[model samples]
Target: MADTGDNSKTELVQELNGLLADHFALYTKAKNFHWHITGPRFRDLHLLFDEQAIEIRDQIDVIGERVRKNNMTTLTSIGSVAKHTQVKDQDSATLAPDDMVKELRDDNANMVARLKGMKELAEKAGDNATDGLLDDWTDMAEERVWFLSSFLK
Candidate 1:
């Protein structure tokens, strides 16, 4: 791993940290909806949210380590996660199941967009590893968006 230039390295770290924060936010929201969802479709949605949450959670550490591999500090606290995340938090446990699915779908869509941005940044930085990892992350988020959209249809 040769140098990526200091400025490019910093930008990549910032983007990666922001992505990491968004993933954490989305993971928590998915778990919340999984636990609070109620309706005739409870079993299907419950399982869906759990599976999505697990996938998001699994990649979180990988994102954090990517930042560390660039010799930068990743988000340290819940406060940092809240500050850096573009994903909005959902506090209502009483939201309709359909609405929950809609929100998650939109959030995952946003994540896909964000991952694309990060991929571009990685490419500009000449960081092939991060760029490749972003592809996997984008696919995961897109899959979640697809699954959540099924509920809307």
Candidate 2:
């Protein structure tokens, strides 16, 4: 890959790390909801949450590696993840099942927006690999949002 110049590379790295942090935060939120979900829809909601959590978890390493592939360090700790993440944490486990679905739906929609932002940065930097990966990730987040939205209706 050709160098996209230092400034472009640095900006791409920052955006990518922000994305990685969001993946971590959202993944943890999904798992937390999975574990705490209860009520008549417990089985369905639990499974859905777990599946979404796994999808997000699977992307974490890929996103982090993209940062490394760009010759930069990725996020190193929970504090750093918190610092960079735009996704808000759902620390209280008391949310109703419908609320859980709503929160996750909204968060996944936010992920799509974040992914699109990263894709634009990647494209501007001429980072084809990152740009392509972000497209797939954006698709995944959109699908998750679709599935979660169905539960709300």
Candidates' TM-scores?
Answer: 0.97, 0.97
lDDT of 2 by residue, 1-153 (tens): 467655777888899999999999999999999999989999999999999999999999999999998889999999999999999989988999999999999999988988887876887788999988988999999999999999988
lDDT of 1: 0.91
**Clashing residue pairs found in predicted model 1:** none
**Local distance difference test scores for all models:** 0.91, 0.92
Residue 141 local lDDT, model 2: 97
lDDT (10s digit) by residue, model 1, range 88-128? 98999999999999999999999899898887788878889
Candidate 1 residues lying further than 4 Å off, grouped into runs, are: none
In Å, residue 13's CA in model 1 sits off its true spot by 0.8
The C-alpha stretches of model 2 lying farther than 4 A from their native spots are none
Give the root-mean-square deviation of each candidate in angstroms.
0.9, 1.0
